[model samples]
Target: MASQPADVDPAEFNSLNEDFYRADPAETIEHRLWMLAAFLADESTNVGGQEELSLSRDEAPYRKDRVQFAALESTLILHQAAETLLRLCLAHWTDAPCPWFEMAKLRQPRVFPKKVAHVSNTLDTDETISELLRIVSWSGDQDVIEAGVKWGYENGWERHREGLRELIRYCCVVIRDGADLYNAGKHGLAILPSEKGVSIGEGDVISVRGPSLTVIERQVQDGDLRWAKVTHWVKYKESIAITGKIASAVRSLWECGKTAGLVVAT
Candidate 1:
């Protein structure tokens, strides 16, 4: 490869030269999904070398940092697995053009659809979840994906669809419970110190004074304030259970999808 001239505009040149968007083969995508599934299954060290059953900090034998990191990572991985599976379903099962929001992210030759671009420029998790629920809802009318699965897999998708619904419900609970804790890890976990700083978790109500306590100091710590500890965060055992459910769901869905994909391929 020849080195570019020092005077050339690097950003523009790189943009022009890069193959930003390439549609991966369905087989490759399937393989990636399986890899994620495997990661979820190997839960040997969810909270710092301790198993998921070790819920309380006392039994975990690990610092809070490690515990927090594992919890946050597992939550994120579960969400990603579900999102990717849904996207694959949309791509393979539906004939509708790719959502403009997704298209904008890809580096392709196709022009963006301006009219729908504004409305569909982002991958809405809620929308995807809703669509997935609808597909498996057992409604009288069959969606494209359902029809394809029935035609190709001969009812293989039926059980998987039921499993998916259960997994979806579990994920929703995990997301709600873990959202604040996960966000706190990314930002900083706000620790409120009081002489009575007993046990606390998410959603434990308390009182707050003017200008929330951002800073802590001996001199400024003069106020009778009360606030609730947020307890929505999932513990070790719960995290493990959630990941296990996700792994099972993704595995089942992938197997069924792959079989159906091959049938259609033939």
Candidate 2:
């Protein structure tokens, strides 16, 4: 016969029950943004480490591969974060109840940009930009303000709102460009490192180069063909740089939203 387990303490059990009940299990857009912020914050450390590795002279095996992987992962996170931020903005601006689950179902590349463009056309005027800047300035974060201003200046945008619109547009582009890669990564798509050779007719090679990583997909239209399609390619360092810009954009929008009372503190 098995020995009986020791009895649990009633007081301890009661305390645990009380704690569980006190915790809020409900999810909200604010909570989702907070979670994404936390994820990006964690990935920032990884990005820094990858940057260091890329600059180092160490000849470790697969060192380049590691950097490339970091870039891919960071870009995916940035795409998701940007999508969520845009959804939150749309919800607030339109006074519609755009919940997280509903937004998650959106075909980001196809649907999000059109909606954002419509809203911007109607509301992103110079006056509104001025109002947004005033609200952002109230946050007292010089870095956030300067980031948007600097980006605007670099793009030759005269108005701050133009810069803001550009930033959002860039995010949409990232989502569109990365859609195949993102879906591949999420859905067990086969990826590999590969190179393409450039040569003359008689095999006189000019050069050979390709993306650091490539995603492989079945050629649905030509299933009878022997070769699979190289659907997407990622230039590792360039992708990493793009991820940095996305992060900065997300931070600026978050700060602006918080200051404007669009986002609540979690």
- TM-scores of all models? 0.36, 0.49
Task: Give me the overall lDDT of model 1.
Answer: 0.40
For model 1, the superposed segments whose C-alpha errors exceed 4 Å read 1-69, 85-163, 173-232, 262-266
Tell me, by lDDT, which candidate is best.
2
Candidate 2 has what TM-score?
A: 0.49
lDDT of 2 by residue, 1-266 (tens): 67644544543433433332232222233354344344434522234445556755433325444454544565465566556556645543422222232344344446666775554554456554443344323322345556655552453434544556566666666655666667766677455544444556566655445544467554455547444556344454455455455455545544444445332333
Best by TM-score: 2
**Model 2 / residue 213 / CA error / Å:** 3.4
Alpha carbon lDDT of each predicted model: 0.40, 0.48
Lowest summed lDDT across 10 adjacent residues in model 1 is found at 209-218
Error of 2 at 111 (Å): 5.5
Q: Cα deviation of 173 in candidate 1 (Å)? A: 4.5
Q: What is the lDDT of residue 32 in candidate 1?
A: 45
| Candidate 1 Cα deviation (angstroms), residue 134 | 11
